[model samples]
Target: MKPLEGLLVLDFSQFLAGPSAALRLGDMGARVIKIERPGTGELNRQLSIKNQMVDGDSMLFHTINRGKESYAANLKDSEDAASVKALIAQADVLIENFRPGTMEKLGFGYDAVKELNSGIVYATVTGYGQEGPWRDKPGQDLLIQSLSGLAWLNGNADQPPVPFGLAVADMFAGAHLVQGILACLVRRGRTGQGGRVEVSLLESALDLQFEVLTTHLNDGGELPQRSAVNNAHAYLGAPYGIYETKNGYLALAMGSVIRLGELLACEALAAYQDPKSWFTQRDEIKQILVDHLQTRTTDEWLQILEPADYWCADVLTWKRLFAHDGFKALGMVQDVGREDGARRLRTTRCPIRINGERLFDTNAAPKVGEHNASIEQEFKLRDAQPSVGQHQPDGGERI
Candidate 1:
């Protein structure tokens, strides 16, 4: 059996961070039910990436929210809020990514949910933490990256600060929330009590740069210096970046500069025999290597370097990576189809294995309110008592 086979998760999160964590839980065999708004559902259903849509919903939504059931309800309505609270009472976990006070206003905050079900693992994601002055700022990936010094880590020293093409902040926060949730789950297994987990995009973004950031903090506040040429890592030394070859690019990891010079037959690299000069004179050494590497194709350089056990590889684009035997051997891709089989989406499978078997789920994301009737019936939500008045001090609408 999968680790989370019997657990039930109520995912109130709309976009990348919280839903991605819910998806990971589902991959581990949790029964995830997404509580979305009526009519409009989650905003991510319309948040398309590269304008790509599938089956009337954004591909971004499907990629992160697949293999889940959706139940539509308006938390602002007394009856709907009561029904949702009832569902939360039976849930093993609850995840939400609304702004700090939104859930509290709806009466589903962690304190209220804990009272409903004392053993529920309550997880939340925000732009910043609840107390920060920037808490109200939009929790967008690019903005978080820019604010957390992540953009400064990319590109050459002279080039403009570069943010990652992907939503690193959202994904990292999701992963962190999962870690916290799983830890709480373990503790619950032993203590018969659950706790709260809180992660913010800004916090996750900062944590991602812990190694360099900590170094900067302790080492007399020395700022990281990216190579002026072939910048890969901000703190790493020469031959630690990608270089353009005759036909393509080659990436070189940390290795002996002298050995690399001998292998590539570049006489200039031999002069930097002192390891200290590798960092101090990195730009000049990198320039020489860059000029020399451009004379040979990537494969030609790989052929010379690979045999000597050098830390070098020919960079592969998506198309090339897909065609490679190494990528195919991993079996990382899977095809998921909607219940009606009207369409199918081919995407990467969960990068995890249990008992030597890779996890695969064929279910696609549910349309808005697709499972509302069945979920209401199964949870006996229709019999729930609605709150009599405004939001309560305990954060319960009135269940």
Candidate 2:
């Protein structure tokens, strides 16, 4: 049996944060009912690139919403709301990402749901929080990065702040939601009562940068301004960045002060042997290393460094990483065939492994209302089906 075998989750969340959390629960064998809208379902369905659906599937939607049963319903309809309440009555958990107070206004908030199912664990994934100054304000991942001081620490010191390549805020919030839900589940097991758990994108962003935030708080130091715009480890000291080799690049992470002497072993890098010289004259040491690295190919450096246990690696692109032996050994990549007779479907698998076995199988993202009939039959909800409301002409206002 899976970890959360008998638990049922009513996922009334859209986009990334809450959906990702719900997917994690689903991975652990929770029965996830993804509550989407009547027409297009999740907003991610329209975020296609160049008129092409990413990955021959809904890329954004699939990443965080796999292994879920879709239930398309317009919550604004009173009858639909009643049907949702019925689902909630039998659910072990309810996860939502609506703007603060929106759920309460619709009469299906934590209080309302808990009244019916006292043991329900309600998780709220918001941008700011439920009752802050920005509670009702609409926020995206970009805004949360700025608010959490992450943007300040990114990019070059002289240039404008840079947005991260990934939706770090949303991803972090999802992780926090998973942690909160697990903790709440344990609490419920002990007390026989459910609890409310809140995870905010802003809070998650801040939490991910705990090292930077805590250092600033304790030392009254300002967040680090990046000297190198594209470098991954911007805050760290010298010898911890990408250096151009004869062909492509090699990344070095020998930045630990204690490891400085060990990393500067090359004859060309002998000048940095003096601890004071290395500490005070980082530019000089960096230039020497850069010059030496430029003489050798990345492969040559890898051959030398791989055996030495130095924090070094040849910089690899996506294609290289996909075919990497390390990931292959870990079973991080898997093949999936489609009914359309596609050549190949190489997809990344879930990371969690228990006793050397994968925790869950690859469950593809469902089509709109794919399992509606099955769910209705299983829960005897066919008789309780809601009359989903129609969208209005004036931008479809919520009820």
Candidate 3:
């Protein structure tokens, strides 16, 4: 049986963080009902028009919102708002990503929702949080990167702070949402009561850089300027970092001090190899190692490094990595929601497995409001109340 077989989740979140948590829960066998703003739905629907489903659905939206049923309702409208509140009352979990005070203004915040369902786990995702100095400030992936110091750590010292490309804050906040929801669920199991589970993009991003943050905070030292391509490994000298290959790049690292010299394939620096030397003269050692690595092609060094049991990897682009046999063997990627069964609609599987089998059901993303009738019937709202009469405003407009 799946982990959360009987649980129900009401997803009022859009974009990344909030939807991500619902998706994970659905994969683990919860009944996730995704509530969208009637007509336009979630912002993610228009994120990648070109990559939309072959059948005209939003693939970008499907990628994260898969495994959940959609309930389109305009909370602003009276009839639709009733349905939303009814769904909230019947759910075990409720998730939203509106800015702080948004839910409260709309009358669906923790207090409001709790009044309807006191045992419901309420999760919120925001740029900063519900209340703080930057609570209402607009927060996104890049903003968090700057506030959390991640942008400053990447790229070269001479260059401006660079983004890490991927939306680390959004994704990490999604993960944090999952963790918070689960924690609340477990706590509710004992107390027969649910509580609020809150996570922020800024806080999540900062939590991800704990190692660097703790060190810098304790030392009260100014963060070192951004390090260059080869210089990113400044913390480790010689035998640690990317080395050039004939056609591409290879990463070689000897995290354990004792393994550094052995991994380098250079017998000349064996004496300076006293790992302690790295702490004292890291700069000189790195220069010598960098000079030596430039002497051999990546393949040549890999051939020796592998035999010596060094931690080494070839840096492959997404296309190359996807085609690699290792990915298939490790079950790192798999087709999702593909009816053809010919492996055409490929998607990376969740990075989790159970008993060697991936814990995912290949379900298509819902067409907008696909579950309206079913959810209405299931929640017994059809006979109890009329639909909210007011029409929902178009999304993208401030409420």
Candidate 4:
């Protein structure tokens, strides 16, 4: 049996961070029920990556939200809020990523939910922690990366700040939330009590740079100095960046500059025999290697350096990586189909294995409110009564 086979998760979150955590739980065999608005559902359905759409929803939504059931309800409506509260009473876990006070206003905050289900694992994701000046700022990935000082670490020294090409802040926060939730689940298994987990995009981004950031903090308050040419890491020394060869690029990791010069037969690199000069004169050493490497093809360099056990590789684009035997051996891709079997989308599978077997699931994301009737019947939520003073201006009722 899967680790989380009997657990139930209520995902009241949209977009990347919280849903991605729920996706990982589902991969481990949890039953996830996504609670969305009645008409528009989660806003992520409309948040497209590269304007790619599939089956009337964004491909980004379909990929992260696959293998889950959707229940539609207007949270402002007293009757719908009552139904959700009843469902919460039976759920093993609850995840939400609304702005800090939104859930508390709806009466589904950790303190409120703990009263309804004491053993529930409640997790929250936000742009920042509850009491910071930057808490109210939008929790977008790019904005968080900029605010966290991560953008300054990339690119050459002369270039403007460069944010990661992917939504790193959101994904990292989701992974961190999952770590906390799993830890709490372990404690609940022993203590018979639930706990709260909170993660913010800004915190996650900062944690991602702990190594370099720690160095910066202790090194006399000096800012990181990015290499003026071919900078891969802000703090690493010479021969630690990608270089353009005759036909393509080659990446060189930390290695002996003298040995590299010997292998490539570039006499100029031989002069920097002193190890300390590798860092102090990194730019000069890199410029010499760059000019020399351009004369040979990437394959030629690899042919010479690889057999000698040098730390180097020929850079591969997505097309080249997919076509390689190494990528195919991992079996990382899978096909998922909708309930009606009328549509299918190929996407990446969960990167995990249990008992020597890779986890695989074929279910696709549910359409808005697709499972409302069935869930209401199963949980007997329709018969639940709204608490006093639960009514609000919006159709939704307070918890």
What lDDT would each prediction earn against the true structure?
A: 0.89, 0.73, 0.74, 0.89
TM-scores for every candidate against the unseen true structure: 0.96, 0.86, 0.87, 0.95
| lDDT tens readout by residue for model 1, 105-149 | 888887778777877789999998998789899888899999999
TM-score head-to-head 2 vs 3, winner: 3
lDDT of 4 by residue, 1-399 (tens): 887887889999999999999999999888899999988899999999899988888999999999999999888898898999888887778999999999999988998888777778899999998987888888899999898998989899999999999999999999999999888888777766778999999999999999999999999999989999899898899999999999999999999999999999999998999999998899999999899999999999999999999999889999999999999999999999898875799999999999988999899888999999999998899886433222111101110
Q: Which candidate achieves the best lDDT against the true structure? A: 4
Evaluated against the true structure, the overall lDDT of model 4 is 0.89
List candidate 3 stretches off by more than 4 Å. Answer: 49-54, 225-229, 255-284, 338-344, 385-399
TM value for model 4: 0.95
Query: How do the residues 1-399 of candidate 2 rate in per-residue lDDT, one tens digit apiece?
Result: 667777888898988899988988887778889988886888876665456464444666666676688987778987666667667767778899999888898888887777777777899998888786898677699888887777777655566777788899998899899999888788777666677999899888988988767767786665454544234444565676678999999888754433543544466555555556544555556666677777878988888777768788888898998698875677776654433444434466667875667864556676677777777677666466432222111101100
Global Cα lDDT for candidate 3: 0.74
> If both were scored by TM-score, which would come out higher, candidate 1 or candidate 2?
1
Candidate 2: worst-modelled 10 consecutive residues by lDDT: 390-399
Per-residue lDDT over 119-216 for candidate 3, one digit per residue giving the tens place of the 0 to 100 score? 78899999998777998888778888998878877765467777887889999999999998888787777666778999999989989988877777
